[model samples]
Target: MKRTLALATIVALSLSLGSCRKKNNEPIAPKPNPEKPAPTPGTNPTPGTNPTPTPTPIPAPPTPVNGDNNNTIKPDESPVNATVSIKLTKGARVTIKSDKPLTITGAKLTETQHTYEVTNESGFGIDGDPETLDLSIAQATEFALDKEMPSLKSLKITTEESLKKLSLQGAKNLEQLDIAGAIADEQTLDLSKHSKLRLLALGNRPDMIGKFTTNLGKEYPSINSSNPSTSTSFKEVSLPTSLEVLFLAKAYCALVGADNLPNLRAAYIYTPKAELLGDLSFAGSTNLDRLMLAYTSGGGALNSLTIKNKPHLRDLFLYQMTIKHTSIDGLPTNTLMYKTTNYHLPSIEVHNTPAVKILSLLQIATNLESADLTNNPDLTEEKLVKIAEKLTAVKGVNLKIEADKATDAVKDAFQKIGWTVNK
Candidate 1:
């Protein structure tokens, strides 16, 4: 019995050892209640599981500096809309390319720089009161005037071609115009619309041949017709009725009928061409204050000078004119005889007038204050004495006679009457 029991204990011990070895060789599982989740391969930790960090911002660039060290605002070089006013100096050359309106006031413009050159394709508007305006463009084509310039008073155009492109329909306040070098053919410049225009100067061009027209109702104050090289004759030109001053130098025209110009105050006519100047009668210009006629070397002879009933004619200047005869029939006889404070006495000036017998015309000018008859070889001492005696209203006179014609007896007689005689 004891031997059988000991064998059973040995078998039980062997079985226990084999079971322990098999448990150690098999795989094992992880715990189900873990503290944190597993990490992702290419991502951050879970948002709720970890704290986030702050980010840094980028900086801006600095302002550029100029060489002068001044904070001057430069003009926008691009062809964009202008937001500020443009201020230009005298004789400043600048180009503008804007599609907006511009105002040129007196404070913003200079007299020497009145021209506005627009380069953009769009039309612009002009505001404010500018006294003078000269508009030009790169192309010689007609442009549009968007608005009226009422304060513009004077306008000067460099060429006639430019004048044709401009439309003066809006510039109603223009007064003075200087178109000195306009050379156009067969183009009539009509200024009848300008009612307030006072002065018109058209000189210094030879080939400027075109019909000029003005209003018959609105007479101009002054007209300068002094082109020397003009060969084109005008078809028809109407002179102003209230013309106060007139200048005619080397004008190629027929006899100017001064009978219509009643208010003529002063006139200067000088023709050096060999063309004949027909009878220039001033019968209608009775209130003529001063008259100067220079028909020198190559000019035509004075066919006749009619001073018939001129009562207010004070001064007469005849230079280098050959007067054959005197027409003083209807002149007032001793009309200006009495020296009065109301009226000025008449004065005569004759230089190189050899043919006219000056003594014959002295009877008409009895109240003569002065007489200058120099370089006249046709006058004799006897003729001068007769002229001096006819001046019965004047006790003394300022006389300048020819050197060769003044004799000693003539000098003594003139000196006795307090007359200044230059020999």
Candidate 2:
């Protein structure tokens, strides 16, 4: 019994020791980091959760895709200043918009060649102070001034061909108008309202041989009546009394009588056709200073060139025509004298006047100071001697005769009277 009890005790002790060894081998729970916070539900984690950041986007540049490749700006598209001067070539057009002065000149491809049209599209016209506009074009068939350029003081139109029409209707203050080349046909020009107009120049064209006519309105007078018999009568025609200067070339219309033009200073008429100049009466043009008539051919004997009682008739030039049976009486002694001096007389120039005797013509101009006779094949030495004897009343006279035709006796007769004769 003692040996059995001892063995049981030892078994129990061995089992207890094995249980203690298993309890000591159990694992310990770990502690959390204090530096990091817990993540939210949907958003990303804190910065420490990610290493790299996202980049921002940049925009692209714009492209130029308008107008010509050369990038030249057009004239109309740009702003026009108050005063502008421009020059254009063929096929170019411009619009000048200014309330001030403007001067423009255009040219063609070459100096002699005509090119495409150059136009001005000013709406309000020139409205600047002292308004002045000058336009010179090489060749233009479609050019004009704006209708309401009322303040325009001076206007010059220089072109190869006439504009379709030029109407100075509203240009009241215009003082000078110069048209270089062609003018509009028929009655395209209106000058009745331009009382202040001073200088007017209309150049002649080859095509306008016998087709030109000017109508200065019926308020003044009617030059030509419907009946051909009374066309030369001064009882129907009256002239513009305020007119100062008149010039007509190659125009075949009858002229208004100058008997009423008291202020008339100069008159020039050049007609190539015969019968272009009808009966002319200068009966009362008291202030008349100069008169010139040049004809090509075909006119009846000018029997009505009556320059009676003219006090200021100074210079007279007649070409290619004769004044036969025309009485030029009552020529004033002080006719050609300067306003400050009374010693100087008038100058008479007779060219191609074959039918009219030069000496008989001088009998009317008593105070004649100078005479130029040329191309008179019918002028004989006897007529020249008569002229020399008749001119003896006038002192300090100068005579220029064709040296090839004058005789020594005729030259001596002119030299004996204190006259300077050049043959």
Candidate 3:
């Protein structure tokens, strides 16, 4: 009866304590281990009442993985060499979560006018294996050649994405753009909106390169195409009214119009076996000053045809061939030129022409200062003196005439050129 009474009293006390704790709400404390002396390693400690040591709670810095919560752009210049990481707007899903090891040689926030050109001017070859060119790999070539960096004036692209990248940068200062390889491809970038563009070279992609010169006579100006795959030629080229220079060098099998290039100031032609002298004459090229017709055959030249209105034709060259009469009829004064050796004296009929101020006959003209003219056996001192006096208008004097026999004054001049004068 006494043991039963003890158990009932303990149960009543436990119930009263629980009810008081629930109502008052005392805070719970973490359990702590009981202190004890160090025991030997081999001995097993008693089980039931054993305890774990308490660990120190430390604070940590905010991080992406941990939801500490901070969203702001950060510049990472050290992430890559000479490169900087900028904040990318969340338009597309950018996976820059650290796994893409980008060892950037360069990084910057840039728009269109700023360009990076990779040129091998020092004649260095790229080194590396082509099979390993998995763009994901650090940009390394299979073979490395010397780096020659020549400043590039312009660039061309057939890729729509690349074009878009360049377009996003800006086109205010772009001088020349070429997409000739993509003109026929619809996937090529559309560049017709670049109104300030002075030069455009396009291919036949038709979509990416777009139909720019279809009404070339009316719409897009200054467009050039030489794509053999898509058959792009001069058939669709429209010479802009503001054009100052037009180069048609290797378009022999491709160029279409012969005279439609109006207002061309400078032109380079290499048409072969073609008779274009009649139709090749400039119609609206009244302002034409420089015209190069190298390697273009079929007889008619500056002198053969009537260039009656080209008063400004200052520079003319008929090298590597015999130009028929009338090739130099209407040439401007002081015309710059070069031709085969004149074994016989040339007839410079335009002599005393007002515009004829400086005439160049020697290849190395700027170096020569005076000529030893007194040596020619056929021409005497009187004749040389006259020629010298006339040539006084020219920058340098040339009196180096060849002959076995020479006058005393001529021998003196020859001595000046290191020749031994006859005793």
Highest-scoring model, lDDT: 2
| Error of model 3, residue 253, in angstroms | 5.3
Model 3 compared with the native: what TM-score? 0.29
List CA RMSD, all candidates.
Answer: 44.4, 44.8, 35.3
TM-score against native, each model: 0.36, 0.42, 0.29
Per-residue CA lDDT of model 3 for 1-423, tens digit only, reads 999999876655434522433332212222222353343233222222222122111111111121101112222323221221222122211111111122222232123222111222111111111110111111211111122211211333322111111121233223343332122212223333333333344332211111111132122122223323222122233334434344433222222333444545555443332233333455566766665454323423332323435666544433322223222234454344433221122212222122222223322122233333222233445543333333323332333444543466655554454434332
Q: What residue runs in model 3 are displaced by over 4 Å at the alpha carbon? A: 1-238, 253-262, 273-278, 296-306, 319-329, 340-423
Error of 1 at 331 (Å): 6.3
> What is candidate 2's lDDT per residue for 197-236, written digit by digit as tens?
5334343212101101122112112222222211111111
Report the poorest 10 consecutive residues by lDDT, candidate 1. 53-62
Q: What is the lDDT of candidate 3?
A: 0.30
Candidate number of the best TM-score: 2
The lDDT values for all models are 0.40, 0.42, 0.30
Model 2 residue pairs with clashes: 274-298, 403-423
Q: Number of clashing residue pairs in every model?
A: 0, 2, 37
User: Cα deviation of 142 in candidate 3 (Å)?
Assistant: 30
- Relative to the unseen true structure, what is the C-alpha lDDT of residue 222 in candidate 2, on a scale of 0 to 100? 21
Count of clashes in candidate 1? 0
